[model samples]
Target chain A: MEENKKKSPYKNKAEKDALFEKEFMHLITPLYNFAYRLTFNEDDANDLVQETYLKAYRFFDSYEKGTNAKAWLFRILKNSFINEYRKNVKQPGKVDYQEVESYYNSDDIDEPITQDLRVDSVKDLIGDEVANALNSLDVDFRTIIILCDLEEFTYEEIAKILDIPIGTVRSRLHRARNILKEKLREYARNMGYNG
Target chain B: MIKTITHLIHRLIGKKEHSYCCKNCINDLYLVLDGEAEQKQEEELLKHIEKCEPCFTRYQIEKSVKEVIKYKIQHKQVPPQLIHSIKEKINGII
Candidate 1:
């Protein structure tokens, strides 16, 4: 029948609700953490995570079942952040991807600093300094670092989440880490770590 | 005689020196750390790290940085209310 064809594959609403709860609810902690890091504010992070979940629930039909729910949710949250907060509030002028790419490429300064043992060791560095240094980075760089280092996502996963090629993920992560190391170097030196 | 035996033992345990500087291993350092490298590349990278000091140090530092980020950044706990609210929102809709 036409009605039968329109119906979802789910046997009942109860089954759908239970499955959604089991799979998606558990990801709240990680989702919020990611949201917080991206927005750097409690209110924004809360709104972001809420918006992400709302969107996910609305589009639940499109989500392929039995796949990576975490990655799926993460992708939604990341895209929402880019479209909503990043474009509207952060930049009045449109974010020029080309300009950002060229800016990253123009800086060859990170090469010498990282190779020369400028920071000595990050072992003794305090949490505040690390957090500061991390937050200081541009959102693009920071997102990659958070995804790769903090969330421990693989490059391929990151490439999928960021909608870029695997090669871009590699190069961007390399550049991001180098920039992070440079930022940490100043803090390390301030802490009197001379190596 | 004892030194020679110890050296032989080290080599037996896969402690042989790396003769050539491998560009692939060096380039894929973070890839290996992030568990993104292919199986064969991972093996080659581990071997290269064992023999190369610079690569080993680089690996250590990157690993340490990862750990630090995971440890410190995770302290931002999500409030209990937020979870309850999200549940409420979902419950209302479903």
Candidate 2:
């Protein structure tokens, strides 16, 4: 049975179309939003979303019906973003490691460590501040925050989507939230939220 | 000397569940707040929070943050044209 399953071909065009329409089309808005946040540009986001959908349609047969179509589609989109978009965006900057190492090895690395404990209650954080804080995060942290908070995906779903263990998801989410809180603390304090 | 005495006194007084100073419990608070902790663990954590003021405050703050993000991010209007084009593009492909 397992051998037969391995040999089985993907869905036919008609079936693929039906499945795509029924199980996957509804995710366009959220998927595009995710893409937009990741790329932070409209055209790039659009391209990523379009590419994701095309790839999803092409690989429709492997998807298990009646079981988390959203996660499956998200997984495909995330892979497309990592493989296609991230590679292209990061490829142009080739840093010289020798120079970087020499600088770090010298006595000039004045990395300051300070903790800001000035605010309480994120309740006063406005929408724009929230968006800014989210956007300012590194991609890994931002992705986890978006998945867990904005999209309301469970940790298990996030683990599956990001292809990481659940423990990593929890730790990353904790770190991400801490970072976001620190970013928003200034805004909260500015609004005179003492508690 | 003062910090060491405080630590020794705390150890002698036996850590109370009502004390909000347990770092371990506070670390697990987010999972409980997010509803990711298992039922048994959830009950244990909730019980701990019931007695711990700091953990409860942390819980409320984190919950509000989650709510704010969810409310703000999803409120952006997805362009109708974008949706239409996506449908068209998918149809054009297969």
Off by over 4 Å in 1: A1-6, A90-97, A106-110, A116-120, B1-23
Interface DockQ per candidate = 0.30, 0.29
* TM (chain A) per model: 0.87, 0.77
Q: What is the interface RMSD of candidate 1, in Å?
A: 4.4
In model 2 chain B, which range of ten residues has the least summed lDDT?
B15-24
**RMSD of each candidate?**
7.0, 6.8
lDDT of 2 by residue, A118-187 (tens): 3244655667888988998878888899998888789889999998999778767766676677777766
Q: After superposition, which runs of candidate 2 have C-alpha atoms over 4 Å from their true positions?
A: A1-15, A90-121, B1-20
Colliding pairs, model 2: none
Error of 2 at A16 (Å): 3.8
* Residue lDDT tens for model 2, B1-94: 4434554576688742222345566556777767777788788878766665555656666777788888865444567777678667777774
The DockQ for candidate 2, computed on C-alphas, is 0.29
